[model samples]
Target chain A: MKLYNYFRSSASFRVRIALELKGLRYEYAPVHLARGDHKLPDYAAVSATALVPTLELDGGERLGQSMAIIEYLDETHPEPPLLPSDALGRARVRALAQLVSCDIHPLNNLRVLKYLVRELKVEEEAKNTWYRHWVREGLQAYERELAQLPPSTYSYGPTPSLADCCLVPQVFNGQRFNVDFSGLPRTMAAFDACMKLPAFQQAQPSNCPDNEA
Target chain B: MKLYNYFRSSASFRVRIALELKGLRYEYAPVHLARGDHKLPDYAAVSATALVPTLELDGGERLGQSMAIIEYLDETHPEPPLLPSDALGRARVRALAQLVSCDIHPLNNLRVLKYLVRELKVEEEAKNTWYRHWVREGLQAYERELAQLPPSTYSYGPTPSLADCCLVPQVFNGQRFNVDFSGLPRTMAAFDACMKLPAFQQAQPSNCPDNEA
Candidate 1:
């Protein structure tokens, strides 16, 4: 298996944490988003959208989208499941994951930021404001949901499930953009707990082979 | 089961289509998004984020996120599955769905549009441009992926899968924004095919109880 990834991509980070948590071994194929490596023909042939975090299986099947790839891994691996056994629990975990992946991250992603700065010519400060705004709104919802559950090591349960896979990355990006975290005690607590685990720590952007700084 | 949904919401439309496809009976509890009904205390108690399309199960278990709700419905229902039988096929379908749900719809949704016009003071025409840009980019990816599959009745196969559930709503929104659909032959074809079905047609915004205009 090989994963075409980028160090700074929150979506790539989500898949990397999932791979590490499941103890899956795969070649690291970095697609440098900053350098436009993903837009090159070699990467474009493998990923239709020229996006990072395309997991190519041993059988030559490729999977795009972080959540989809993570779900595929959980289904095939089975042990240390990323989702809960019960349907309702699974729904909650998935909802939390989508809250970050869909509602927050996509709006502030690299492409969207580029469009804002280049096409719309949005000011730098306003761009950062855009990033922070979405992050705060997303984490606020996540924090509320986490507060509903009893305090645990991870988002939905004691074990780090799919929500943690998503949460840790969003928090990483949030801190980069200097989003306010003071009100999100539970979310920050969950992030801190997940970061303590080797899987998440090893999957950080700074730890990746293509880390710039 | 009861669904708290807003007629014009693409996310709510996705779940409604899924429910119809499964032949399940669900009471439609419309939350008028444009009127700010979702922010009211009653709806907020059900959906912490005050987002449309919150599904309350027979036992009163609440589920949020349209994709998660649809997946939960698939898991418990399981007759005509939303995902393919093969894991790889399932992954493909999910990636296609996320390309729209995460990449396109969230970026141009009512809240984000409101932010652009109200908070950022972006003009209406510029806001529509932003909407069209994201929709075009997202659908370009979708069309590329769909082109890879053998000619079929739906996005993935003869049967309408989860990707179609996501696609039809996106195309509906794209048309509303007057996005250029000329380059997307496959995607438009899939949309046309999907619209032929009663499930897609009946779940449309015009058919909904809360549809204002």
Candidate 2:
């Protein structure tokens, strides 16, 4: 499998973590979004939506959307389950994942912030304000949910599931923007614990081939 | 089961389609998002995130997030399966669903749009531009995928599964905004066919209890 990824993309970061967690070997094909490489014709053919983190397979299968790609990998290799076994438990994990993936992260993606500055003519400080507002609101809800778990170490259970995959990347992005995770003690705690694992630590944006910094 | 819903919310509409498709019996508990009803104490207790369409099971199990709730319903009641039996097929269907759920719809949701116009001081034309920009991009991908299918009346196959559940709401919202559907004839055809089904027809926002206008 070949994953067309961008280093700073939280969506791609989440996929890398999932792949690492599942112990799958894949080639990384970095598409630098910051450099407009993702918009090139060659990369555009692999992904119709023109988004980074497109997973192309050995058998000519191409997949997009980080959550969908993660689920695909989970289905193909079930060793480290992306989801829980039980129905309700699976729902909880998925809801937690979506809370960040769908609700929070999408609002603060690089493209969105760029749109605020370019299209909407918003100032730089206002753009960061917008990012922090959604991040804070989202982390507040996440902290509320995470603090209620029996153990505050992980998002849901002992093993890192979908929630942790989303949390680690989101926290990384949060820190990049200086969103101040100081208030989200439970969320920061879980994120810290998840990053200690090899899979999570190795999937950091800095570890990617296209890391600008 | 009791579904905490708002009639016009696309997320809640998706759950209604799933429940109606599965022939599940449940009481409707409406949460009016426009009137600050969802911010009330009782609703806050059920969903810490204060989002609509939280499914409360008969056994007192509470669930949040639309896709997760739909997955739970599918798992518990397997007669009309929402996901494909095969993993790749499931991934494709989910990708199609997420194209709208994650990418297009969230940006145009009432709260997000409200934030743009209110907090960011983006003009109405810019907000509408933002909405159509995403909807057009998403529908282009959706149309391509729909065309990839073997000329079926539906998005994937004959039966309306996960993809159709997502397609109908987005198309409805898209049409409401006067977005052009001519380019997406494949998706338009599938949307037309899905609306004929009782499950899809009944799940229309106008069919709900508190459906205004």
Candidate 3:
């Protein structure tokens, strides 16, 4: 398998974590988003959306969308299941995952931030304000849900699930933007718990081969 | 079950089509997003995010996120499955669904638009341009993927899979923004095929009891 990844991309970070969690060995094909590599013909052919974290199977089939790829990983390699057994539990985990992936991360992704600066001519300070506003709102909601759920080492259970995979990357991105995590004790606690695991630790952008800084 | 829906919300429309497809009867509780009804104290209690399309089940457990709710429906019902039976096929369907749900819709949704106008003070023309820019880029990618798949009556196969459930509403939104559809014949064809069905037709915003226009 070859994962077309960008170390700093939250979406790519998600697939990398999922692959690590599943203990799958894959070639890392870095498509540097900051350099517009994703828009080049080759990467564009691999991903219709020209997005990062496109997982190419050994048989040469390509997959996009990090959550979908994560679900595929969970399904094909069922041993450390990323989701729960029951339907309601699966829904809970997926909902939590989407809360970060869809609501928060998408709003503050690099492309959207670039759009703010390039297209909207939004100043640096206001753009940071925009990023933090969505992060705060989203993490507050995440914290509320985490507060309601039963206490565990992770966002859901003792073992890390899909929610934790999504949450950890968002927290990484949030910290990069200097979004305060002080208000979200539960979310911060879950992040703390996940970071203790080798999978999450190794999946950090700083640990990736393509890490810029 | 009760669905807290807004007729014009593409996310809510996805759940409505899924519920209709599964032959599940659900009470429609309209959350008028335009009027800030979602921020009310009662709705805040029902959904921590205060987002529409929250499903309150018979057991009084509330589910948020349209994709999560749709997955729950598919799991519990199982008749006329919304996903493919195989893992890879399910992944393909989900990727298509998220291409719209996660990538396209969230960027142009009501709240984002509100932020552009109210906070950023972006003019209406620029805002509409922003909307159509994302729509065109997203739908073009959707078209490329649809063209690769074997010709069928729907996005996947003969059945209305989750991809179709998501595509119809996004097409409706694209049209609302006057996005050019001629370049995306595959997407338009899939939209046409789905709209021919009573489930999709009846789920149109115009057919909803709370539809404003």
Report residue A22 deviation for candidate 2 (angstroms): 1.3
Consecutive 10-residue window with the lowest summed lDDT within model 1 chain B: B145-154
> What ranges in model 3 sit over 4 Å off?
none
Estimate the lDDT of model 1. Answer: 0.91
lDDT of 3 at A128: 95
What shift in Å separates residue A84 of candidate 1 from its native position after superposition?
A: 0.8
Assess each prediction's global lDDT (C-alpha) against the native.
0.91, 0.86, 0.90
The list of candidate 1 runs beyond 4 A from truth reads: none
Candidate 2 is scored at a TM of: 0.97
Residue A42 C-alpha lDDT in model 1: 93
Ranking by DockQ: 3, 1, 2
Q: List-wise, what DockQ does each model earn? A: 0.84, 0.80, 0.87
Supply candidate 3's per-residue lDDT for A20. Answer: 90
In candidate 1, position A30 carries an lDDT of 88
